[model samples]
Target chain A: MTQQHKHIISMLVEDEPGVMTRISGLFARRGFNIDTITVGKTQTPKVSKIVITVKGDDRTVEQIEKQVNKLVDVFKTIEMKDDESVTRELCLVKVSLSNEKAKTDIMHYAQVYKAPIVDITPKSAIIQLVGKPQKNDAFLELMKPYGIKDISRTGTTAIQRGGNGEK
Target chain B: MKGSEAIVKTLIGSGVHTTFGFPGGAVIPLFDEFLRFEGKIKNILVRHEQGAAHAADGYARASGKPGICIATSGPGATNLVTGIMTAYMDSSPIIAFGGQVSMSLIGNDAFQEADMMGITLPITKHSFQIKKANDVVPTILKAFRISAEGRPGPVYIDLPKDCQVGEVTKEAPKKVDIPSFKPVYRGNINQIKKAADMILAAERPVVIAGGGTIIANAAKEVTVLMDTFMIPTATTIMGKGIIPEDHPLAIGQVGMHGRKAANYAVINADLVMAVGCRFSDRITGNTSSYAEKAKVIHIDIDAAEIGKNIEVDVPIVGDSKSVLSDLIVVMNEKLKKKTETEWSKRMKELNQLCRCNMDSKKEPIEPKKLLFELNRILKTDDIVVTGVGQHQMFATHFIDRMKPRTFITSGGAGTMGFGLPAAMGAKVAVPDTNVFDIDGDGSFLMNIQELATLKEENIKVIPVVFNNSYLGMVRQWLEIYYSKRYSQVKLGRHSDFVKIAEAFGLGGIRVEKPAKIQDALKESIRSKETMVLDVYVEPESNILPMLPPGGHLKEAFGGCMNAKGVFF
Candidate 1:
């Protein structure tokens, strides 16, 4: 059987066109499916940081990390499974509140969860919640009894908690 | 100026003529601006934000243009995530503009404030938050370019309320200056040469084409290679119609529920030239055993997909059309056609055997027969879209897509409700062309709400529902491996789809008899508005030629055997 392991990869690269294409293309050529990828600008101008989460064996991930780092625009690439990282996700949920009683009940739950009421209409109220994915999920389950209508969640984003920010 | 006015102007400047959205508190100002610019930019007020997202997706898929959708902060924005993920999976270009809390209150737990950027990061190709109104124009331009460029997917832009209301004294940048965004279009010569050499040396070679080929418009180049080398080609679900199904080199689709001949050829081949395909698990059943004897040469535009699932012996990264062209050039220079008459003969025999096994009875309305009849009625230029599940597999198996863009289905995501809206978009894209959405009863209801959108747009699309009254795919699994637990697969609740269509002010027809299918379809096609033909199918019917999950492609069960061990 093929060995499978979860890998978290971090990269510092020049922010430009087709870089993502090139990076994703490298993974595609190797037949590597990216489980998750988060890209955002760093504090410095013209630089972006990309965190890619992949599920593969250690050897495969090492090979992928090496190939990715060799790309001209990539400044650095590091596998983050060994590093301390802070992962966060955000979610917004709409709860159906047909009457004032349901609305007030939902507000009380929101207060307990520290979720803010974002939008309120006579029929429904939207709540904004941000935390680890598990926390958001727990909050959503708590609200489910109140008649949740819809949910939107961002998968996951990670940053090194406290380490060499630059590679 | 109000934030709403800035958003409207940015949309107009981005060349968005139509937008789908619902209003909320955070976006009330934007809705007000939408009213002011009602004539300039058509704002569609969908019943739900989810519907708005699907409508935008439909518009984008049909028009080959980026579809735009708007939603307020929190729930309204979150509702668009499903649509966003759907677009992302299918590689459709769409722009989702989400309302955000004011910048000052972004992390203060203010009203209508949700972290839109963080929430949509995984599903979106890229996303941004506007800190000032001046950034809106440039951001819109960048978002459009990113969403529509090579291997197009969905992008998002979150507008904070304060930024939309802020002043913009300077003009937005005419163009973005990201140097790292260039996609590699041309194939590397050495890699192309190595691939060509391998193909030339192999006695039995099969080509697995995927959605990337269609996206890259590489069909012509693929045809040249197949014809020159007499290589048998099979397609992924997304790759249907990239080559005419009737072409001699075409061996049909491969993987779970794929054609037996196609799977056999892949397993027996000395070399597998996988072009523009990701080798999704649906196509490769058992990862360790798949193509065990073959040298796998995987070529794709997206480098990340190359060895993620299946390892490759030789990898080439570039646009499918360009890479195939270069490979062809090298092959023409260094190689001669190597004939494998015995292998070809065996393949033909297997194909015949599989077809014979799948051939169903003429009476009591066979699903395959329906597909054949639909194929017979369709013009070569007509477009066909399918909802996910058994019906989707059946359509991909039987339909003859002779032209490019003739077959449109949600392949990657396999989103259930994608058929109707996508068909609507296809019709809107090619107004003169006929488009049909072949759907399952279970899948159809997921987006049946879009029936109203079709009526409002006045777009004509023929919807043929295979009313099996169950989730046929799941039911098939339960029957084969799960002891027929049934679970929630049965559609016990009554839903008169015909009546539902009528409720939406569209044409409706119900076909109980096999003989009525043609007439019902013809009438629906002739109708000017959206039409639904709810055809009752066999309740216990299962899609045949099944390769059980994790089973070798070669180990296919011909069909469901009766109690007497007789194949259906």
Candidate 2:
């Protein structure tokens, strides 16, 4: 039997119109579900990096990687292994300041997690959190008791740990 | 120069002698330029845009050049979707051009405007929309390059009406630069060496080839490798003619309706070397039980296809022709030729068993018997194209294609209307070669309008229709799986096909009896004009040696269905 696990796939693609659609369309067409995806320009002006996370058996994930690599716009596709890469996700959470005790508890949790309070109003406070997706998930869970109002997240993005940064 | 003239000049400059297209409002400027440069390119006007697309696909499959098809935007471009998908699935090279409305009115959904690039993106290798007159030459040239290179497929170009009418000064580029689209042609030396060693060690080895063999022109290389090692071979329908069916080691095609010997060979082989073939589900029914004993070595030009369908022990990514050449060299260096083995003897016995009732003399002609007659009549190099149905399977069973590109069909897409126009396109590509479309009543009617195109173009080809009066393949499945609870599969015989052919200004022959099939075929071939032979065949007959849907290879059934509705 094969085991299913999360796979972080990164690609260097041409910075052209519809490149994102081409990438996402391929995943949809091939029936590979994307758990989360993030894209941004690389150091090279003409190149963009796309990071996608999908959960599948190793074989299916490998097939997805090969299929994505076949697109003409893609230059390279690599699996960003958890051990050899640093993955980060930025999330913003808005929490309701229900009471003095609730606000103090929320501030204590934010400090412990190193999440800075970016905005504070009379009734609500917006905290910015940057960490691994799982750590952010834990942070969201802690803020739930403080009456979480809304949330925004930039999905997981990754780079290799050392000097070679996805050439 | 006008952009229309630039487009025409680029086509001529790219060594395109013929193109299939239909004129409409958006493409008037482009159509006018065909008259301006009269003798340089032959523009064959087709009845429908779908016909244009299929004709182009057929031409590409036959001539190994990228087939060109042009259509106006909106409905015309949308009509081409099926044919483009057919070419896309089979990896046949075709360049499809759709004339859009003016650039300014693109987003407004102007009359006769369509998003050709957006529509064709999933089906084509690449697509481009020319933004201005100056971009026409370069984009068209790039489309041609992309279509024919690597694993060849359709490439679509959206030509706005303004771009076609506007003036252009730019010259055609000397070379196209696509930095991210390089295709690997040569296999890794280490992998090639490993494959050769594996072949040498195995006692029961089978080579399964597919459409990529024909696309790469690697039939000779494949044949040489199998012959040198005394290996029996089977082919997918797409790879039908890659190996001459008459060869001693050939076990015939392997699939749902494949030969028993071929399926048996694949199931029992200790080593399976799949060359230029994607293991489609039809080829490997019930994947868990398919070739469970075989150590598979898959070779294909596309890395994505290597393990897309089936797992492999060794995967070599390279063009079939190049990889096979290297494998042949490496194998010959360290090995001595082995004579006929026990496996070959068993293959011969199985083949003989499979041929028991193929020559049956029945009243309403047996499907296999009709093909047996066709097998006797057709020349080795004569091209035979078939639409999807019972007749196509019968052709696959009995057609003895001795050359590459001789047996063309919509293998992946299974498009019903592909035969007639595709045959016409093959004839256009190789005018001297005799081309024939072996079709069914159901499949023939789907593209019957192409008969007008045939009459107009004066393209000489023969069409043999097995008039079963029903969607025979679907009806057979209904009978088998649904306990004979038939549905809308019956296409009642209401119209006279022979009269229909005559109405199109072509000679028509009707063959009702088994004995008349030969003379009807002979007369059609002897006649210089296009002829249609409407051969009325056994209506209730089902294709045999069929593996029940999702059934294992070892469980495939042959012979007739019994009174209890079970195949014996």
Evaluate all candidate structures by whole-model CA lDDT and list the values in order. 0.80, 0.89
DockQ of each: 0.06, 0.73
Determine which window of 10 residues in candidate 1 chain B has minimal summed lDDT: B559-568
Docking class of 1: incorrect
| Native-referenced DockQ of model 1 | 0.06
What is the model-wide C-alpha lDDT for candidate 1? 0.80
True contacts kept of 1: 0.08
Show pairs that collide, candidate 2.
Answer: none
Candidate 2 local lDDT, B379-401, one digit each (tens):
98799999998899888887788
lDDT of 2: 0.89
How far residue A36's Cα lies from its native spot in candidate 1, in Å, is 18
lDDT of candidate 1 at residue A15, scale 0 to 100: 87
Tens digits of lDDT, candidate 2, A1-167: 69989999999999987788888888988999999999999999899999999999998999999988888889999999999999999999999999999999999999999999999998999999999999999999998888899999999999998886777
Candidate 1, residues B78-133, lDDT tens digits: the string is: 98988899888877899998988888888887877777776776577777778877
